[model samples]
Target: MLAQLTNVSLSFPDKKVLQDVSFTVYPGDRISLVGPNGAGKTSLFKILTGRLNPDAGAVSRAGGVRIGHLEQDLSDSASGHELTCMEAALEPFAGLIRLEKRLEEIAVKLGREGHASVLMEELGEAQRRFEDSGGYSFRARTEATLTGLGLPESLWDREVSGLSAGQRMRLALARILLEEHDLVLFDEPTNHLDVPAREWLEGHLKNSKVAYMVASHDRRFLDAVSEKVAHLDRANLSLYTGDYTAFRGQVERAEEEGWRRYEKSRKQERKLRRQAQDYRAWSEAGERAKRGAADKGFVSHRAAKVMKRSLVARRRMEEAAENARAEKPFEGDEIKIGFGPSRGRGLIRAEDLTIGYSPERPLAAGISFDLSAGERLAVTGPNGSGKTALLRTVLGEVQPLSGGAGVSPTARVGYFDQDHRLPARDVTALEILRGTGDETLARTVLGRMGVRRETVSKPASRLSSGERAKVLLTRLVLGDNDLLVLDEPTNHLDIETQDVLLGALEGFPGGVLFVSHDRHFVDALATKTLRLGIT
Candidate 1:
C-alpha cells in the first residue's frame, strides 16, 4: 500500500467532522473522494499528507514514499520569486538540473586532462544517472504539461508573478504533475480550468501510473478519471467500487434497500404489537373468570392455567415487538430554492455588446441575446473569453464598451458571484439574511439549504466554499427576485445538491443567466446558449 488511514476520527469544538474513517491508497489506484460541503474532505487530505493530525486513529505509509498534494490556495506558491513559468514548472527537477550541470563540468575536465581513469568513470556514472532520471526529456514533459493545462507558450516566458490567479493555479498543477510522486492528492483541481483544460487533465490522470485521490465537484471529470469512489457523509466513510456514475447507482440502490428493510421491520413490529394486545386481553378475561368462578376447585384451577398460558404468550409477543422495532432512515438537509412571482416577460437584452475593462481593447464584441421570464440562458467559452464581463455588463455593474445591454426596470435581480464573496468577514450568515426582517423565515431557509444552526451562527469567513454558496443561495431564496444571475453556480456544490438546485431552477418562474463550464449542469438547465470567442 502507498498509504493507509485506519479508524480515523476528527472533531472540532462545535461539530464532529469525521468518525471511524478508514481508507487506503494502493499502487496505481484511481479514487475519487466525494462528499457534501463541510464534510471534512480537506481535513482528510491534510491528514494523509501529514499536515494535520487526526483526533484519533493511525496513518501509515510505505517507507520513502513521496506524496504530492495540490491544494486550492496558490497565493504562496511562487511568492517572492521572479521565476518565469518555465522555470517554476521545472523546479521539481532541481536534482536532475544539477546533475546535468555537473556532467558538463566533467566533460570540460576530461578535455583538459585526457585519459584520466577516475574522471572517465565519474562521467559514465553521471550520464547514466541523468538518463535514468529523465533529465534529457524533462523540459519536453514540462512544456507539454503546461500547455496541456491551457498555459500557452506565450505565457511560459512571462514571470510567474505576472500570471493571473487561474494561470497560477494551472502552473501549480503543472509543477505537481511534473514532480511524478508515488501518489497525488488533488483538491478541486478543476476549479479554474476550462472545458479543454479539464479534459486534458482527465486524460493525463487516466494514463498516469501514479496513484491519485481527487476531491472534485465536477461530475463529468470524476466519471472520466475515477476507478473507485470514497464517500464521506454523516461523519463516516463508505467505499464504492467503479466510477462516479457507478458509485451513484450503488448508493441509490443501497438507499432503496435500506428503506425496504425499514418498512418490513415496521410491519413486523405492528403485527407483534397487535398480537401482544390480544393476548393481554385474553389473559385479563381468564383472570376475571377465575375471580368470579362458582364451581370451586376445577373451574378456578382451569381458569388459572388459562391465565398463565395467555400471560406467557403476551410476554413473548411483547418481546418480539421490541426485537422487531426499526428506526426511520436518516435524510440530510436539502437546498430548497424558489423564486417569487416574476413581473417582467423580457428580463434582459444585449445588442451587439462589446465588453471589456477598456474600450480600446475589448475582450469580446458583437454579442446579442434576449432573456425572458422562465428562460435559462448559459454563457460558455474558454477562459478569458469575456463570459463574466458579459454578465456584469448585463447587470449594469460594468459599462459596455460599445452597443447596449439592458435589464427591464420591472426586473428584480439576484446575483451569485463566482467568488461567493460575502458582505464582510466578521458577518455571520444569519446576520446577512436577517436583513429580510424575518428571522424565523431566514433560519428556516438556511436550514433548508443544509446550513446547520451552528454553521449559520459562525462568521462567513469560517464557512467552507460549499457552505458559503448555500448561504448566498439562501439569501437569494429569501428575496423576491424576477431574474437570477449565477456565475459558475455548480462550482463547489456536491452532485446531490446540484441536482436539488437544478430542480429548483427548473421550477423557478424567473429567468436565469449563468456562466459555467460544467457540461452536465449546462446541458440540464440551459434553454439557450451563447458561445463567446476569444478576441
Candidate 2:
C-alpha cells in the first residue's frame, strides 16, 4: 500500500469531523474523494500527508514514499519569492540544476586550456549521475508538462509572484507533475483550469504510473480520471469500485435499500409496541382486581403469577422496541430562491459592445445579445475572453469601450461576483444576510442553504469556501431583484448545493445571466449561450 489509514477518527470541541474512517491507497491508484461541502475530505487529505494526526487509530505508509500535495493555496513559500516560473517549476530537480550549472562551469574552465584532469573526472561523474536521474532531457520534460497544463514558454521567464491565481495553480500542477512523486494529492485541482487544460490533465494522469488521490467537485474530472471513488459521507469513507456515475448509482441503490430496511424495522417496532401496550393494560387490570379482592380473602396465586408474567413480557417488548434502529428517512434540505416580480421585458441588452479595461485594447467587440424577462443567458469562453467584463458592463460597474450595453430602467439587477468579495469581512453571515432587512428570512435562507445555525454568527470571512458561497447566494436570493447576474456560481459549492442552485435558477422568474466554465451547470440552466472568442 502507498498509504493507509486504519480506523481513524478526528473531532473538534463542537463537531466530529470524521469517525472510524478507513481507506487504503495502492501504487498507481487513481482515487477520487467526494463529499458534501463541509465533509472531512480535506481533513482526511491532511491526515494522509501527515500534516494532522488523527485523534484515534493509525496511518501507515510504505517506507521512502514520496508524496506531492497540490493544495488550493498557490502561495508556496518553499518555492521562494524571487524564483522565476521555470526555476520554480524545476525546483524538485535541484540536484540536476546544480549539475547542469557545474558542467557549464567546467566547460568554461576547460576552454581556458587549464590542466584540470580532476575537473574532467568530476564532470564525467556528474554527467553519469545526470543521465541516471533522467536529467538528459529534463528541460524538455518540464516544457512539455508546462505546455500541457496551459502554461506556455512565454510564461517561463516571468516571476512566479506575478502570475494570477489560475496561472499559479497551473504552474504548481506542472511542477508537481514534473517532480514525479510516488503519490500525489490534489485538492480541487481543476478549480482554475479551462476545459482544454482539464482534458489534458486527464489524459496525462491516465497514462502516468503515479498514484493520486484527488478531492474534487468536478464530476467530469472525477469520472474521467478515477478508477475508484472514495465517498466521504457521515464521517465514513466508503469505497466504490467504479467511476463517479457508477458510484452515484450504487449510493442511490443503497439509500433506497437502507430506507426500505428502516421502514421494515419501524413496522416491527410498531407491532411490538401494540403487543406491549396490551400486556401492560392486562397487568394494570390485574392489579386493580388484586387490590379489590384483597378484602375478599386474597387473590388466586395463578392470577398473581399471570399478572407478573404479563408485566415482564411488556417490559421485554418495550426494551426490544427501544433497541431497534429505526432511523427517520433522509430528506435533504433545499434553498428557497425566488426572484421578485419582473417590472418589464428586455432586462439586459448589449449591442456591438466592446468591453475591457481600456479602449485601446478591447477583450471582445461586436457582441450583441438581449435577455428578456424569465430568460437565461449563459456567457461562455476560454479564460480572459471578456466574459466577466461583459457582466460588469451590463451591471454598469465598467464603462463600455464602444457601442452600448444597457439594462431596462425598471429592472433591478442583483450581481454575484465570482470572487465572493463580501462587503465586510468582519461582519457575520447573519449580519450580511440581514443587510437585506429581514433577520428571520435571512436565517431561514442560510439554513436552507445548509449553513449551520451556529456558524451564522461567525465572521463571513472565517467560514469555509463553500459556506461563504452559501452566504453570498443567500444574500443574492434575498435581494428580490428582477435580473440576476452570476459569475461562476458553482465554483466552491458541492454537487448537492449545486443541484439546489441549478433548480433555483431554472425556477427563477427573473432574467438570468451567468459566466461559467462548468459545462454541466451551463447545460442545465442556460437557455441561450453567447460564445466569446479570444482577442
Candidate 3:
C-alpha cells in the first residue's frame, strides 16, 4: 500500500467531519472519493496529505513515498515562487539540469588539447547516466504535459503571474503531473478545465502508473478514471470495488435488501406481539377458571406459568425486532428548482448575435435562436467560445457587438451567473428569501432545500457553497420569474441535490436556458441545443 488510513476521525467546533474512516491506496489505484457537499471528503483529503492530523486513528505511508496534492489554492504555486511556466513545470527534474551542466563541462574539457581521451570517456559515462535517468526525455514530457493541459507553447516562457486564475491552476496541474509522484490527491481538478482539456486529463490519468484519488462532482469523469470508489457519507467511508456506476448499483441493492429485512422483522414482531396478547387472554381465562374451580392452587399455578411464558416470548420477539433494525439509508437533501409561468410565447430571441468585447475579435458570431415558452435550450461550446457571453447578451448583462437579442416585455428573466455572484449586499438566507414577501413560503422553500432553520439566520458569506447555491435557487424560484437562465447550476451540488434539481427542471413549466458541461444533466433536461463555435 502506498498510503493507509485507519480509523481516522476529525471534528471541528460545530460539526463532526469524519468518523472512523479507513481506506488503503495501493500503487496505481484509481480511487474516486465522493460524498455530499459537507460530507468531509475534503477533511479526509487533508488528513491523507498530512495537512491536518486526524483527531483519532493512524495514517501510514510507505517509505520514500512522494505525494502530490492538486489543491484549490493556486496562489501558492510556481507563480508565487516567481518562476516562468516552463521553468516551473521542468523544476521536478533537477537531475536533468545537472546532467546537462556536466555534459557542457565535458564539451569544454574536450576543447582542450591533451586530455581528449579522458574527457571522451567521462562524456560517454555522463550521457549513459543521463539516458538511464530520463534526462533526454524530460523536456519532451514536460512540454507534452503542458500542452495536454491546455497551456500552449506560447505561454511556456511567459511569467506564471501573467496568467489568469484558471490558467494558473492548469499550470499547477501540469507541473504536478510532470513530476513523478507515488500518489496524487485531486480536489475538483476539473473545475476550470474545458471539455477537451478534461478529456485529455482523463486519458492521461487512466494511463499513468501513479495512484490517485479525485474528489469531483462530475460523474462522467469519475466513471472514466476511477477503478474503485470511496464513498464518504454520514462520517463514514464505504469502499466499493468497481467504477462509479457499479458502486451506485451496489448501494441501491444494499438499500433495498436492508429495507426488506427491516420490514420482515417488523411484521414478525407484530405477529409475535399479537400471539402474546392472545396468550395473556388465555392466561386470564385460566385465572377465571381457577376462581371458579375447587382446585384453585393448581389452576393458579398454570395461569402464572402461562403468563410468565407469554411475557418471555414477547420480550424475545421485541429483542429480535430491535436486532434486525437496519441503519436508515442516506437520502440527502433535495433542492426543488423551477420557474414560474412565462408570460409570452417567444421568451427570448437572438438574431445574428455576435458576442464579444470588440467586433474585430468576436468570441462567437452569427448565433441566432429563439426560445419559446415551456422550452428548454442548452448552450454548449468549448472554453472561450462565448457560451457565457451569449447568455449574458440574452440577459442584457452584456451588449452584443453585432446583431440583436430580445426578451418579451412581459417576461421576467432570472439569471444565475456561473461564479455564484449574488447581490452585493451582505444578507442572511432568510433575508434573501424574504424578497418574495412571504416569510412562510420562503421558510418552506428553504426547508425543502434542506437549509437548516438555524443556518437560515447566518450570513450568506458564512454558508458553504452548496448552502449558498440552495439559497440562491430559493430566491430565483420564489421570484416568480417566467424564464430561468442558469449557468453551470449543478457545479458544486452533491449528487442527490443535482438529481433533485434535474427532476425539477425536467418538469418546469416555463422556458429555460442554461449553460452546463455535465453531459448527463444536459441530456436529461435539454429540449433544444445551441452548439456555439462548432462550425
Candidate 4:
C-alpha cells in the first residue's frame, strides 16, 4: 500500500466536514475524488500529505515513498524562475545531474593518472548509481512530458519567467509529471487546459504507472482517468468500484432504493394510524354504554371490560404507528432558473467578425452567425482562440477589430463572466440580490441554491469559488434576461449543479450563446456551434 487513512474524522467550528472517513491507496491505484463544492476534498488531500492533522484517525504510509502534489494555483511554480524551460523541467533530477558530472570528472582523472584501480572502482560505482536513478533517460522523459502538455520544442530553451499564464500552468504540470514520484495528487489540474491538452492528460494518466488521486469537476475527464471513485458527501466517504459513470449509476440506484424504503414505511404508518382511530371509536362507544346503563352493576361491568380492551388495543396501535414512522429521505436543495419573455425575435448577429485586441494580429476572423429567440450557439476552440473575445464583442464590451456584430436593442442580455467576479467585493450575496427590491425573493433563491443563512450574510469576497459562481448564477436567473451570454459557466460547479444548469438552459425560451470546455454540456445544450481558430 502507498498510504492508508483509518477512521478519520475532521470538523471545523461551524460544521463537520468529515466523519469516520477511511480509505487506502495502493500501488497503481487511479482514484478520482468527487463531491460537491465545500465538501472537504482539499482538506482530505491535506491530511494525506501530512499538511493537516485529522481530528481523529490513524494515517500510515510506506517508508521512503515520494509523493508529488499538483495544486490548483501555479503562481509559486511560475515565479522566480530565470531558468530556461528545459532547465526548469530538469530541476527534479538535480542529484542525478550532479552524479553524472562526477562520473565525467572521474574519467578525466583516470586519463591523467594512468587508469588507477581506485578511480576505476569509483567510476563504476557512480555509473551504476546514475543508471539506477534513471539519470540516463530523465532528459528524454522531461522533453516528452513538456511536449505532451502542449509546450512546443521552440519554447524549450525560452525563459520560464516569460511564459504566458497558460504555458506556465502547463510547465508546472510537466514538472510534477517528471518528478518520478511513487504517487501523485492533482487538484483540478485541467482548469487552464484546452480540450486537446485535457485529452492528452487523460491519455497520459491512463498509461502511467504512478498512482494518482485527482479532484476534478470535469465529468468526461473523470470518466476517462478514474479506475475507482471516492465520493465525499454529507460528512461521509463512500468508495465505489469502476469509473465515474459507474459510480453515478450506483449512487442513483441507492437513492431509488432509499426512496422506496421510505414510501413503504409511510404506508405502514398510515395503516397503523387508521387502526388506532378505529380502536378509539370502539372505546368511545363502550364509555357511552356505561354512562347510559340503567341496570347499574352488570351492564357497567361489561362496558368497563370492553372499554379496557379497546383502550389497550388503541395504545398498542399508536406504539406501532410511532415505530413505523420514517423520516423523509434527503433530496438536496433545488435550483429554479427561468428566463423572462423576450421582446424581439433576433437576439444577436455577427457578420465576418474579427475579434482581438490588436488589429494587426487578430486571434479569430471571418466568423458569422445569427441567433434568434430560443436558439443556443456554442463557441469552441483551443486555448487563446478568442472565444471570450467573441463573447465580449457581441456584448459590446470590446470593439471588434473588423466586420460587424450587434445585439437587438430590445433584448436584455445577461452576461456570466468566466472569472466569476462580483460587482462589489464588500457587498454580501443577500445585499447584492436584495438590491433588486425583493429581499424575500432573494433569500428564497439563495436558500434554494444551498447557500447557508450565515454564508448569505458574509461578504462576497469571503465566499468560495463555487459560492461565487452560485451567486452570479442567481443574479442571471433574477435578471430576467432575454438573451444570455455565458463564458465557462460550469467551471466550478459540481456535477449535480451542472445538470441543473443544463436543464435550465435547455428549457429556457431565450437565446443562449455560451463558450465552455465541457464537451458533454456543449453537446446536450447547443443547437448550433461556432468553431474558432481554424487555420
TM-score to native of every candidate shown: 0.92, 0.89, 0.91, 0.90
Ranking by TM-score: 1, 3, 4, 2
Candidate 2, pairs of clashing residues: none
> Model 2 — TM-score against the truth?
0.89
lDDT tens per residue, model 4, 1-535? 9999999999999989999988999999999999987789989988888988999999898898888888776755643578988888888888998998999899999889988999999998999999998988888888888877878798998998888877888888998987779989998888878788899999999999999999998989999999999999889999999999999999999888889988999999999999999999989999999999957979988999999999999999999999987778788555454445767889999999999998887999899999999899999998779999999999898999999999999888889997797999999988778655556666666665657788998999999987898788777767778898999998878776787678768878889999999988999999999988733
lDDT of 3 at 75: 49
Per-residue lDDT of 1-535 in model 3, one digit per residue for the tens?
9899998889998888889877899998999998877788878877887888998999999999999888876745653547888988888887789889999888887787556787888999999999998888889988888888778888888887787788889988987898779999998898878777889899999998899999988888899999999998878899999988899999999989888877786777677667666766765675576566656677667766776676677567656656655555555454444345557788988999889977778898888899988899999877778888888888888899989998888888788886676674479889887877678777866765656789999987788776888888767767877788998887777676677677766767778899988777888889999988733
Cα displacement (Å) at residue 469, model 3: 2.9
Better of 1 and 4 by TM-score: 1
On the 0 to 100 scale, the lDDT of residue 183 in model 3 is: 95
Which tens-of-lDDT digit does each residue in 397-446 have in candidate 1? 99999999999998888999988989899999888888756777777666
> What CA RMSD would you report for each candidate?
2.7, 3.2, 2.7, 2.9
Candidate 2, 1-535: lDDT as tens digits: 9999999999978788889988899998999999987788888988999999999999999999998898887655357658899999899788898988888888888889675898888879888988999888898888888887778888899998888778888887888788858999999888888777788889988999999998988888889999999988778788999988899999899889989989889988998999999999999888877777765645755557779999999999999987775777677654454456778887888898889999788999999989998899999887778999999998889999999998998887788897787888899988887767778767866765678899999987798877887898878767767898899988888777777777767878889999877777888889999999879
In candidate 4, stretches whose alpha carbon ends up further than 4 angstroms from where it belongs are 73-80, 106-128, 154-167, 290-298, 333-338, 435-441, 448-450
Task: Give model 1's TM-score versus the native structure.
Answer: 0.92
Please, what is the whole-model Cα lDDT of each candidate in the order they appear?
A: 0.88, 0.85, 0.82, 0.87
Report the Cα lDDT for residue 290, model 3. 57
